[model samples]
Target: MIEPPRFFSAADASIAVSHLFVRPDMLITLGFYKRKPGLSREQFSQHWREVRGPLIASNPILSKYLTRYVQHHCVPSNGWPNVGDLEYDGFSESWFDSLEARKEMHALPYFQSEMIADEHRFLDMKATRILMFDNQVVQVGRDYSAEIAAGKA
Candidate 1:
């Protein structure tokens, strides 16, 4: 018999959203920058909370369609310098306006050039779009058997 794949133990978080703005033929990308060594977690958290956090926070396009979920230890193999588990939630016709706005925002010199330049401290970086499915999709449930004097799956 085969066993289930082991999950990662260091998932930063997961942002699931419809790729409504990017062109149908163009791939919707998720950019992740690696954290440079000697960077403390607190410092890392603070930078996002104080700087980048506001940018993304203020973006009506992202706020409206993006859903951020906490994922602890979800990418064990993706070390500190790696960006793990980038995802796309497919497309939705209703998000066309938001998508257009996002494209325009990305085209901005401040975002495209400056921000891109500022994020080069990380170790590993990667990006991908959904052509097939992704990492395991697991569902949680109560282990009724444990309580009933039996067991589980």
Candidate 2:
């Protein structure tokens, strides 16, 4: 079996994470979630798009740490059939300036209580998964970041 070449300390891993990725300007987190048992997809979607989105917007502490936030609703696709474990109801992508900033946001009282309960209303926390990474911009057909930020998009 293949094995690690050498032991890695947290500092070593942190340095690699910052420099190894193509995009280091921001750290992006993808939170994949499954609906709570007995909750319908429509109900989950409505609550996520309506209640959760607005809740985050209203919370200033969350906004302080989040540079960008987006939600992705899972849709049926013919290319790949949904299979067990691989199926997720939806996912959220949020960008933070640093790992410490994200951690601070999570530790806030408002996020720990109100946010946690709100998520529990429609999500099975046990089935939720989180992944963090930096992206590589391979190609862009359209550029809209500036326009969108300026409220012109």
Candidate 3:
């Protein structure tokens, strides 16, 4: 009898996401003019262009902190690439002395002002799911075949 080496499952690589709201400005800027039918690639590109800068700017301080504390967040990349059904949502986090820090961010006028639903309107998407990620690993490969072969992923 032969035994096969145990490998981690795909779930092991998955991360949790929470409260993902598309920024309103991103909707129009993304040229996602239609609220019905199907989502288009043109719309996706526009959304990224409009939303990325503000999203990055809002967390400059947090980005620095996350780079220091989190391994995955520290990777230097202007944008993330997609693989099949999976999308790399990028990485970021905040370091706080207490929950008060979080509350302060939420209570900020700017944070409160942006509406996620309005942004998702173009896609006609009424619902969004948030997942929470605990443990995660970074995997990279020129091709899918290499990634499957290396358990390191």
- Best candidate, lDDT: 2
Q: Global lDDT of each model?
A: 0.37, 0.74, 0.35
Per-structure clash totals for the candidates: 7, 0, 5
Which wins on lDDT, candidate 2 or candidate 3? Answer: 2
Estimate, for each residue in 31-116, the C-alpha lDDT of model 1 and write its tens digit: 33334456654554555455555655566655444433121212234565666553321111112123344456557766766445
Which runs in model 3 stand beyond 4 Å of their true positions? 1-39, 55-103, 115-118, 121-127, 135-153
Q: List the residue pairs that clash in candidate 1.
A: 8-76, 9-73, 9-76, 10-73, 11-74, 21-99, 34-122
Model 1 misplacement above 4 A: 1-33, 59-103, 121-153
Candidate 2's error at 40, in angstroms? 0.4
- Cα-based TM-score, every candidate: 0.35, 0.70, 0.35
lDDT of 3 at 40: 56
Instruction: Write model 3 residue lDDT over 101-124, tens digit each, in one string.
Output: 444555655555553433454333
- State in Å the error of residue 138, model 2: 2.6
